[model samples]
Structures are given as C-alpha cells and as structure tokens.
Target: MSFPEDPIACMRSLQAEFGDLAVLEEKGQRIAFVFSPELNRRVLTDPTNFHSRFFAVRGGRRSAQRRVTSGLLSVNGSEHRDARRIMMDVFAKKVLPQYHETIVGMTSDLMADWQTGQLHDLNEEMVTFMVRMTGALLFGITDGEYSEELGTRIDHWVRQNHRVGMGALVAAEEYTSQYEQLLQMADELEVSIQDMFRRHRQAGNSAQRPDVLSLMFRAQGTERELSDEKLVGHATLTFAAAHLTTAHTLSWTLFLLAQHPDVAARLQQELDSCTAAGVPDFAELQNCTYLDWVIKESMRVLPASSYSQRVAVAPVTLGPLNLPAGTPVIFSQFMTHHRGDTFADYARFLPQRWENAKPSAYEYLPFGAGSRMCIGASLAMVELRTILAVMLRKWHFQIESGATVDGRVIATMLGPTSSVPSRLIAADQIANTVPVHGSIHDLVELPSEARTAVVRRAA
Candidate 1:
C-alpha cells in the first residue's frame, strides 16, 4: 500500500486495522508499528533486543572527518552507558539550582524585546529564545549571535531531514540539494563546536565556567575522556535536541493557555500568589502546582518528540507477534498520549486531570523512560517552567482569530506548521478586564477596549 498522506492518520488507521502490533511492508522493507504503552516500554527499555541505530541514522550518517562522532543516541552497550553517565554530571540535580538564575535572566532578556501590541509568531520567537538559552547553558556562549546563526542552520537541516526520509528510492534533485545543505551545516556546526572547545581549553580549569562544555573539559584524560568526535557529536545532539523539543513544548503551552483563558487565569493566579511582583525564585517556581499541570497537559496534547524508532537487533517476540532481526519497530508518543483508556476526555485541555491522577512512566513517556530516557529531561523541565512562569506573568496572549494552529511533524518533533499568530497584551493592561474562563473560543472575544488597545499599540 502507498504511504498515507497524513502520517498521524496513517498510524491510527494501521492500529485500527491490525491492532496494536501492526506489521507493514514499505519500500520493500518490513516494519512493525506499536501503539500500546506495554510494547513501547519493551521496545524502549530493552535496548539489547531493539537497537537505536535506526533513529540515529534519521539525521544521516556520521561525518567521516570524525572517527567517533556518534552521540549517545546512536551508540549502544557500554559506550552509551559511559557517555550518559559523564553527561549526567552536568545535568545532575545539584547543578540544576545553579542554572535557575541564568535561565530567568535569559527569559527576561528575550522578553525585553517584545513590543506590547505587535503581532508575533510565538512558535518562531520561542525557537529563537531557546536557541540562545541552550547555547549559553551548553557552551557558555553568552552572545546570541552564534546561537541565532546555529538555530537558522539547524532549522534548515531539520526541514530537509523531514522532507528526505530514507532516500533509498526517491532521488529527487531537491532532496539531494537539501541533503548537501544539511551536511554543510553539520560541518559548519562541528567547526563552531571545536572552536568553543579550543577556547575552553585555553582558559584552563581555573577560568572555566560551569557550563556543559566546561564539565566535558574536566573529564578529559580521565576514563570519561570522550573522543573529539564524540564530544562534537554530543554537542551537536544537545544543541538540536535541547532547544527544538523544549521550544516546541513552550510554544504549545502558550497556545493552549491562550485557547483556555480560565486555565491561564488560574495559572497566573498561582504565579502571582507565589511570586514577588511576578518574578518567582526557583523554590517558588517549583511550588506553582497549577503551572506544572498546564505544562503537563500541553505536552500530553502535542508532544515534542512525536514518535521514536528502533530496529530489532535479534529475532524477538513483541507482544504476540514474532519479529525477525533487522525489522524496524516504531512507537509513538502522540498515539500513546491520546489513548482514551489512559487519558479521559483525551482531546480536552484539562490541567485538573493531572492534579489527582498520576500515570506511570510507561503511560507518559514524553521524555521516554528507563535507561535510554532523555538525559536533558530535568534541565528541559526547569527551563520550560521558568520561561513560562516569567512570560505568563508579563503578558496575556490572544490567538489571532481564524488563524490555524495545527501540528506539523518536522523531523522527530511536532511543531506548528507556520507561525502561531497571536497578539500579546501587557498584563498590566488586562489586569482590570473581566476574567473569562473555559474554551479558548470564549477568550478570543476580548472586550472592545482590549481590542482597541491592541490596534492602538499596533498603530
């Protein structure tokens, strides 16, 4: 059968037709698709049975210039464990507290550029903000110039990657061109990472900052002395994964809040109660329970990493079906998150659902679970909560009437197809407006004065 036009719909159709473990032949290759949480857990947790090399190649081959540029996502066995352990030191709980001040400061600096009445594509804006933040955290690059440059390049690469899937049969010129461009960007990025490494080395241990780069440098000559290739690979993966996923999550959360004013108002109230003049410290940010629920619900609705892929390393039984070695296995966060059995009123945006019910890791694998779980999950959460808290406190947003906000799968993550067009009204201006609760449809009908304010400021 020809590949379905809508990938999401295709997955649903397959599940409906063939049950949870559906096998399909595409382009002369046999692949297994899994939807239930149990199978997803088995595929993700049992790396020995299902290897991640397939997903790693999703970005294309490792650069030949680097002998060992394969990052943790691409590697398996002892190497994966060692690299993950070394990297975890930088993202450890203890180090998270140190990043709080930096993250808040970054959010403030980004917000400073926002003009009250001007229309903005929150999706694009969030991507820019996250690129800068990740750059600082990963490489100690305070100036956003390099980060912005990298972000633009990465966007191009991601778009191209999505467009040109396996590229085994279709050899279109556009695909070839995009693939070349992607490789060139990857090369440029590697050079930039090497420059950062060199600069960090020259500065020496005494002058080193507490960023991820510094931590990696400290590991040199030790058992964890990652090869230059591995270092570059880690840096590239972190830059792409860290910013893209978190930015998408933030954008979705903001959009959901705009659609659900009652939720936004309640979230803001919680923020106001815990924060001083709208700024929350790390402890206070953690205490904003409703804000956490909003984020969780947003992710549940539109996950950043939509789906994950693995290839069977050896003949294995997945549920009732037997799969041969080299068979590709697929599991989707989008499907699992929307499962009716796991989430009631799955389509509705209800943060309250999480207040009492807690799903196990198998049920909610937004960042994946077990040994191969995302190492940056902690840092990503902290960044999301802190950024959202700061932004929600400062502005009330309204989605542009008639504008479409839909998910477009780009590479591994799902983000807006285009700009999530919306207008930002300064919180002080809306503080006096009557609070509207319920569906975003209701919230879009702003008072005449508020509408006038938006137009007036635009003028």
Candidate 2:
C-alpha cells in the first residue's frame, strides 16, 4: 500500500468514497483500513486475533535502542499484564494532586519569559513545556535545565525514529543511511537514564518518592521483576506517550480558542467563576464543566493520533471480508471523529456539542480505547486543565494575520508542520479571529465570529 502524500486529507477522501471499510494490497500481503466505531470496537476488542504491533523494525538484539523502544506498548500477554499492574499505582487518582502542584509550578516557570505583547512560536513553546512537565512527572527531577537536556535528547531521538521508520517501510536507502544516527542518540539516552537511576538511588527514601520512575523502582525485586533493560523501556515509553500528545493537544486547543473568540471569552468566564485568584487547583478544575467540553470538542475535531496500526495474528473474518494472518490493519480516529452520521455539524468547531452528547468510548477516543489505551491519560487531563487555566487567565492568544497554519500527521500524531507564530493579547482585551493562510482550513471549519453559528440550533 502506498502512503499518500497528504494522509489526513487522503483518509478523509477514502472514507467518503468507500463507506466504512477499505482494503489495500501491500505487495502480496493485505492491509485492512477500517473507519467506523463498530469496526474499531471489533478489531480492538479482539486482540487475540489482532496483536498490537506498532512497527516492524527493531534496532538490534542487545542494543540500548531496542531495550528502550520495547516499552509497555510493545509487550503483550503476561509481561504486559504484570507491567500494567505495577505501573497502575503511579497514575492512581489519589496521587493526582501531587502531580497537579508540579504541573502548576512548571507552567509558571514556562510563562516566566512571556510579556504582554510578545510574539512566540506557540507550538514550539508547548512542546518544550510538555517535555519539562513530563520529566518532572517521570523522574522527580527539580532542576529545570537538566530536565530539559534529557527531554530534548529523547525528543530528538523520537523524531529520528519516526522519520527513519517511515523510510524503512518502503526500503528507502536514504532513510536507511540515518539508521546509525538514531542508535547513537539512543546510546546517549541510555546513559542519561542510568545517571537518573544513580540520582534516584542516592536520594534517600526513594521508595516513598511518587514519580513514575521512583514507584517503578520500588516495584523492582517484587513478584514480577523487571530487568534494567526493560526499565529503560518503561521510562522512555511514559515520556514519549505523555510529552508530544499532550503538547499538541494544548497547541490545538489554544489555537481553536483563539479563532473562536466567543468560545474563548465564554470559557474565560467559566475559568473566572471556577478558579481562585485566576489559577484553578485540581478541585476548581473539576468544576469547570465548560472547560471540559472545550478540551473534549477540540480533541474530537483534531485528534492528536490520527490512526493506529495493528497486525492480524490469526486468520479472521471481518464482516463480509475474509483476511489471512499477518495482515496489517489500520483504524483511523480522524475518520471516526469526523463522521457526520455520529456528530451533527461535525465540521464546525463547536464546544457546546459535548454538553448533552454521550458518545461511546470507541466513538470519542483521543487517548484511544481498548485495553492498551494510553497509560498517562489521567495525568494528561489534569495537566491540560492546569495549563489552560493559568494561561487563559493571564492572556488572550491569537495567530498573526496572514500566517500560514498547517497540520500534518507524523509518527501517528497530528500537529502543526511549522511554527504557529502568535501574538499574546492582554486579558482585558477582546480577541478577534485573524486571516490564516494554509491547510488548517482543510481539517477545521473556521468561520468569522460575525457569521458563526452553534452546532445545536437551540444554542
């Protein structure tokens, strides 16, 4: 199967032309592309038939890159179950408040350089912000610069993997050449992680420390003992899972709010009503129902992960079609989210639709659905709420006029292709939609406020 140049647009077009299911021949093997909630539920629920194999390439047998890449998502069966059980306490609901304080403090540090009228690359800012925030949650590191250094290395390593892996898909020589660079980055990351472990061990009473790495350390030598190699895998996976996805979500949410001034103004009102001294704590964030709706609606409209990959382990029948084993299957969240049949006025950016809406787990999955759903989802929600609350309370955000806004799906995540250069407005000033030039118009329906209408006529 050919990877289309513009995958987001291509998927949308394919779903329109070929109803729910489309199959393609990848050389001799078949690949199933399903674009409906029912099909998604069927495929995801039947993991015995469809094993979750994200990519076909593994770096080397004993390489640090291989160890780090084979995290929780890559493992299956009993190993997956035991690892999930051990990691569950790290993200439990009761400990969320501890993580909340870290997010708020880090958010404050991030905005320390911001001025009233400064222009900034909003997407880049979010990426860097999440990298630090993720580090604190994962490693319990208080040093911002050190955290940024580690996070930056991991970020570069991840970007290389996405680029090189895609090239390997088609056996491109150009991408193959960069393969060694990826491994070298991984070697550096492994050393940093070892240093992290040393610091954790040196820090007294690490068993009581609550970061993911600390908790995971406490679990070592227990019934399900994880090797040092697999420990690297877990840490890398947690960082990768939370960092970019949450960052892109924040970027997209803010961009949508900027474009829809009415929604932004209204949400700010909710923030004012719910928060104390312009910053919402975890309790206050819970009460901001409208804020919840906005996040939900934003993810539904432009989800971070467009599509996920799976492989059929056993020969199976999917509806009218019969498929052999080893068939690669792709189910699109973008296609499912944009379906007009499920969501009325689906193309419009309307936060109010989520107020009375009751979409199923499979229907509205940004963190995804099924047993292998994202582990850091709860942390992500609290992080999003905290970041948005503090930022919106301080300033209004708007993209500069005539700036080109483009979104592309890379490494299974949909985010901006270039800098979303935007200027900050005073909290006292009202924001207006600007003239944006690019492909963001292809994915989202942006109408100026004067002519805007709610998805629901009653509103």
Candidate 3:
C-alpha cells in the first residue's frame, strides 16, 4: 500500500489491516513495519542484524554530515559498545544533579520573560527555551555565547535534516537537491562542535565543568577516550536528540493538561503540595507520583519521537515476510502505545492508565528500548519534571478557543506545525478545556465536548 502526506494516518490504517507486521514498497524498495512488542523486541534486541541507519543519503564515506550524525543511534557493534561505555559515565546518576541545576537555572531564565494574560505560541516558546537549555547542558552555559552559537548551529542543522530526510521516505528527487544544503549545515555544525572542544580543552576546567562536553573531555586520559571526531558526532547528536523532542513534550503536556482540566487540577495540587517556591528538588520530584503519571501519559499519547527505522544487516524474516539484507524496517511508538488490546481506551489522554498499567519497553517506548535506548532518558525526565513543575506551578495556561493547533512528523519527531496560541494565567487560576481544531486530531484522540474529567486519589 502507498503512504500519504500524513504517514501517521497511514500507519494507523496499516495497524488495523495488518495486526502485527506489514511490508510495503516505496520507490522499488521493500520497507518492513512491525507493531507488536514481540516484533519490537526481535528487531531492537539484535541490533547486529538490524543496524540503525537513519539517513537515506549519507553524502560520502568521509562526509561531515555522516560523521556528525554517527553517534550511538547510527553506530553498530563494537563502536556502539565502546561509545556507550564511555558515554555512560557522562550520563550517570551522579552527573544528573549538576545537570538538574542547569535545567532549573535555564528554566528560571525562560520563565522570567513571562507576563500574565500575555499570549504565546507555546511551541515557539518551548522550542526556543530548549535550545538554550540543551546548549547549557551540552556545553558550558557560563560563557553563553558559545552555547547559543553551537546550539543555534545544531538546531538549524537538525531542522534541515528533518525537512530533507523525511522526504527521502518517498525517494523524492525534490529532496535530493537539498541534501547538499543539509551537508553544508553539518559542515558548519561540525566546526562549532570542534571549536567548543578546543576552548573547553584550553581552559583546563574539564574536571570542574559539569556540562556534557566538559565531562566527555575530562574522560580523555582513559583507554576508552573518544577521538575528536567521535566527540563531534556525540555532541551534535546529543543536542539534536535533546532539543526539539523535549520542547514538544513540554508543549504537548501543557496543551493536554489544559484540555483535560481535572487532570490539570489534580496535577496542580500535586505540584503545589510537593514543590517549594515553584521549583522541585530531585527528592521532591520522586514523591510527585501523579505528576509522573501525567508526564508518562503525555508521552504515551503524543510522543515526540514517534517512529524510527533500522536497516537489516542480514537476511531476516519479520513475521510472515522475508526481508533481504540492507532492507529498512520500521517500529512505531505511537501505534504501539495506542493498541486497544494493549491499553484499554488507549486513544484518550488518561494519565490514570499508568497508575495500574504495565507494558513492556517495546509496548510503550517513548525513549525507545533495547541497547539503543536514549542515553539522555534520565536527564530528559528530570528536565521535563523540573520545567513542567516550575512553569505550571507559576502559571495556569488556557488555550485560546479559536486557536488552531497542528502537529507534523518530521524525521522521527512529532512537533507542532502551527503556533499553539495560549494565554498565561495566574497560577492560582483554573484552566479549562476549550474546543479546538487541527491536524493534532490526527495524532491524539481528544474529547468531542468540553471535558471535565476529574482524577481523585484513594487514601
């Protein structure tokens, strides 16, 4: 079957028609699609056979674009093992405390710009805020200029990659012409990453600096020291991985909370009761269970990184289909999380579902699973929790009734395609769900009428 302009709609259709596995031809290539958790396990567990290669066109063997994008997600076998081993220390539990301080500080910086009753495109606000936050966490924020410049470069490069690479799904020649533009941005991005590395090295504070770049640099003397080239790829991918997805999650979570007010009220109460001074400490966050449920449910329903593809390294059979080596296989977080059999009333935004729900990694993977799972998962959770708590505790948001909200799937991330216009209200004010319209309907199931769903807790 052929896909449409909206691939999410197509995937839903495929799920209904083909329960577990489906294969379709696009531009003379057979692409396999897997839906079930078992199938997801089979594909993700054996990365050796199903290698992760995201870009349809990787310029050349030594292209800057190819190298910069070759971090953990794109690498395989020994290289992945080696990289993951060294990077693990950088993302370890201990480092997250320092990272937490950065997240809180940057979020506070963004919040300082707000005025009540003012309207903002939440998507734009979140995206811009994340650029600064991701940069500070990746490179030192103390300098600000380097972080802003590098963050801007990586952010631009990612938008280019998504704009061109998504079209590659159809093998459209229209996208081929822009591949050079994508590579050109990569070249610029690589230079910025290298320059940051040199400055960080020259400063001789790798040990003291807690940003990810400095931490990676500090690990330089070990046998597992990553080369300058690998660090470039790591920093680039890490920023790309951390930036937009978290921003979109923040946007979607806020919108969803506004749309489901009772959930919002209960969540607000939890945040109000647990957090002090509108900012939550790590210890306070661990006890904010409902807030956790809200974040998990938000991700489950409108996951930012919706679907990803992997290429087979050898001939393999997925379900009833036999695939040759080098074939691209697909797995979807959106589809898996929406399964009726797996999650009852799965389409609705039910944070309560997570209260008693237990699904395997493959069944509900927002950050993916297996060995290639996102390295920043912990940091992402902390950032989301801290920011959402700080922002929500400080202000209640009301989505404008006539505002049009839309979502688009570019590359693997699903983000707002239009401005999510909303007004910031006093934190003590209550938020209400209003009727809205857009392609956002294509992504999540929303209430037909004004929703007043309340979630009461048991003593």
Candidate 4:
C-alpha cells in the first residue's frame, strides 16, 4: 500500500500500518510482510521449505535473472549448506581474527591521508576505502594492479545501483543502466579475483596465499569448488555485499555522531579512555564498549536492508496468519528494531539502550536472524570497531551546517544519496582532551607501558 518513491519514506509507512504483519500487494501479487520478531525467528530458522527465491527480480525478465541467483547468497539446500561449511573454515572465528592487523593497517592508512575541514562525499570516500580493504584482505587482489581501477568502478556502480527505483522516469533509464553496470562491475571484480584463485590453486605452498583465496582452493580440494562461473558469481557477491554494507553502516554511524554532539563527546571520552592515541592494537579494539553500542544503535536505527525475504514452498501457519504455499515472506529489521514496546523512544539515537538491554532472538537483527544470518557479522564488528576507533583517535568531525543526512536503498544495502555531506577535524587539532577508557571484552586496550611490558616479557 505504501507507494512512496523514497525508500526511507516507504519503510516508515510500512512500519506504521503493520505492527507484526502486512501483505504488500502490487498488481494482484501479495507478498507477505512479517514484522514480528517471533515470526521472523520461524522464517529464518526453518530453511527446509522457506528458502530464498534467488531468481526473483523486480520488473524484470525472469529468464535472464536465473544466472544471478546461482551463487551462495541465492541458492539453498544441501549444496548451500556444504558451501557454507567450507566457507566457515575461511571466514571462521580463528581466521577472521587474523585480519585484524590488516584491517587496522588499512584504516590507519586511509585516515592518515584524510583532509579535514572540507565537504567530502562520505559515501564515495567510504566505498573507496572499503573496496581497497576488501581487495587486499578478502579477495586477495594485488594493490598495484586493481586499487585505482576498483575505486573508480565501485563509485560508478554505487551511484548506478542507487538510481534504480528512485522514480518513474529515473527508474526507466537508470535501472537498466545500473543493473548492467552492476553485472559489469561483477565481471571486473571476478577477473581480478580469478587471477588470485588461479595462483593460489597452482601454488604448491599454502603459506603464500592470503587466507580467503586459499580457503577457496581448499574448498575446491574437498570437491566443494564452485564452477568457474559460480566462482565468479560468488566473488561478485562478496565484493558487492562486503563493500557497500560496511560503507553504509559506517556512514550512518558518522551521521549519527554528527547529529548528536553530546553523544559524540561521550564517545570521544570512551574512545580516549579505551584506546591509545595512535593506531589501534587488538586489545584496544576489544576494549571499546561504548563504540560497540554506538555502532549497534546506528544499525538499529537504520539497518542496511530494511526487509529480508524467503519464499514459502509449503503452506504454514505463522501465529495468527496462515500463509499459503508460494507466499513470499518478508521481515523488516528496521521495523523490528524500532518497536517502541521493546525499545525506549524507538525513534531516538540512543546507544545507552543497549548498555543493559538485550532484545529477544529476532527483535534486533541488524544482521538477519538464524543460520542464514550474515557470515560477515563478526568480521563486520571487528572492522567497524577498528575503523571507528582509529578514526576517532585521529579525527573529530561534524556535519556541515544545513545538511541533512539521507538514505537510499541500493540492491541489498542502504547508502547516502549523491550529495550527502560532512566536515571533519583531525583529532590532534581538536581542543578537547578526553581519556578513552572502558571494559575489555574479547579485545583489550594496552597503554604504552603495557606494550613495553609485553615486549619485554616476550623477550
């Protein structure tokens, strides 16, 4: 029923009308939209008949879209489970931790060169930084060859992808161009990743290969290898998902901080007390509690994908509603995250809500719920904390006057519109000096003395 062209507006309407469930009917096709946390749990947790319809596209030729759904994101069944198992080894707990150094290094390098006190397009800068980070860590692309070109294409692709479904005229011309460019960007990304895969496969020594690419080779050894086309498809999904999701989340975090200077001041206090004034060490990132809450709150207020879907292959009764077979069930993280009964002042930007609060299983799935929940969820935490900590340690920022932070939904992710703006001041330049301190979780914060003590103890 909500026909607003803007994604944010459309989502607001959907949240208002349907507390737990609302069916979106367009042209006589009813897609069941479920906002209740309990129902969302059942849909995500039960995968047997409620699997993703990877082939479904909006206003498209269905036949042409079959190829797109062949990757891990779209496919399900024993095969999907097996592939996920293989990926678990690569993106697993132990393996993901190793990238912390690389992540910290990448973040520091970017912030080191950032120019403060200027109106910069936050989305574009974030995409560049994210693409570079993914290239080096996730896909194993050599920096010299792909870094410059990847930045260019990612910016173009981000713009094109956002243009889709913006309005009638824009949708007509822009959607097609954007879809074509997205596929092209996929192709470009795959070619680069393919070279890395080929090298890792052929190399006799495992030590030389980066973790993810080597994991792909190992999966191949176990007869888990995807076909060349499927490999490219998987790589494309990883690139697009990893890059934009992180970029959008980080942008939103910054936007939130800019909007609430008091929150920003408190955050700086936490960061200064928790992390050293230089680059983040592993311990420092783990110790930044308030930073974690801020990121979680930001994700809650504006999740990357408002609605996640699954197609019902068999009839099932979900609470009060008995959905028929072939029903496409949708769940909104944005709606669920803002449910006032669960959260205080649901619309406000409040990180403290999570300080002593824990919602039920499906209530706040910034990352989707259940088994199909984002594989990158943990990795995202590390990266977000690392980048936010390092950036805050180095720079303090504010939004430009009279500018409002806005969002647009691109395929599977949310991002700022073309002209979103902000201003930055390097932390060293700021007059305020607040010592960062907090409780240590899995990560610890080490002072300079502690660093020396550890080194001395090791020696």
Index of the highest-lDDT prediction: 3
Distance from true location, Cα of 285 in model 1, Å: 1.2
Residue-pair clashes per prediction, in order, are 1, 1, 0, 10
| Leading candidate by TM-score | 3
Using all chains and alpha carbons, the TM-scores for the candidates as numbered come to 0.87, 0.93, 0.93, 0.80
User: What digit string (tens of lDDT, one per residue) describes model 1 on residues 1-459?
Assistant: 232234566687888898888987754668688999888878888978887752232444556323223666767888788888888887898878778888889988878878777798888888888888988888777779877886666566545554544442233345545555556655776677677677767767623475777777667657446777778777776776788899889988887777666677788778888887856788888788888898888888788888877888899998788898878787888888888899987767788999786888988989988888989988988999998888878887777764544566656677766677778787643323322222222212344433443454458
The residue-by-residue lDDT of candidate 3 on 63-168, one tens digit each, is 8988898887777899889999999998988778787777777778877979998998899988877877887788776665656677778777777776676566
Tens digit of lDDT per residue, candidate 2, span 1-459? 245356677676667787788775544645678899999999988877888765455688998888878887777767777888878887888878877777888888778888877998889988878887888889988787888898888878887886686565545577778888999988999998888888878886876665778778777868457777788888887887788899899999998888888899899888888898855778989999999999989999999988887888888998898888877788888888998888998978899998788998888788878988887888889888889998888888867876777898887889988889888887766578877766787788887541232222225
Clashing pairs in 1: 259-440
What clash pairs does model 2 have?
1-26
Location of the lowest summed lDDT over 10 successive residues in candidate 1: 435-444
* Cα-based lDDT at residue 330, candidate 4: 69
Candidate 2 or 1, higher TM-score: 2
Arranged by TM-score with the best first, the candidates are 3, 2, 1, 4
User: How many Å off is the CA of 344 in candidate 3?
Assistant: 1.3
Q: What is the C-alpha local distance difference test score of candidate 2?
A: 0.81
- Which of the predicted structures, 3 or 4, would earn the higher TM-score when compared with the native? 3
Candidate 4 residues 1-459, lDDT tens each? 242254345655666777576666665556676777887888888998798753343224332233433556767888689767766777777776678778877787776657767667677788777878877776665572475465455445434434542322223453555565555554555455466567645655655555465567556666635666566546545655677778878887776675566677888888878777667787777888889999998888777766666888888887788778877776778778877788877767788888887997798898787877887788888888888887887776655543434465544465665544666787644322122221110012222322343344448
From the highest lDDT down, the ranking of the candidates is 3, 2, 1, 4
Which model is ahead, 2 or 3, in terms of TM-score? 3
Whole-model lDDT per candidate: 0.73, 0.81, 0.82, 0.65
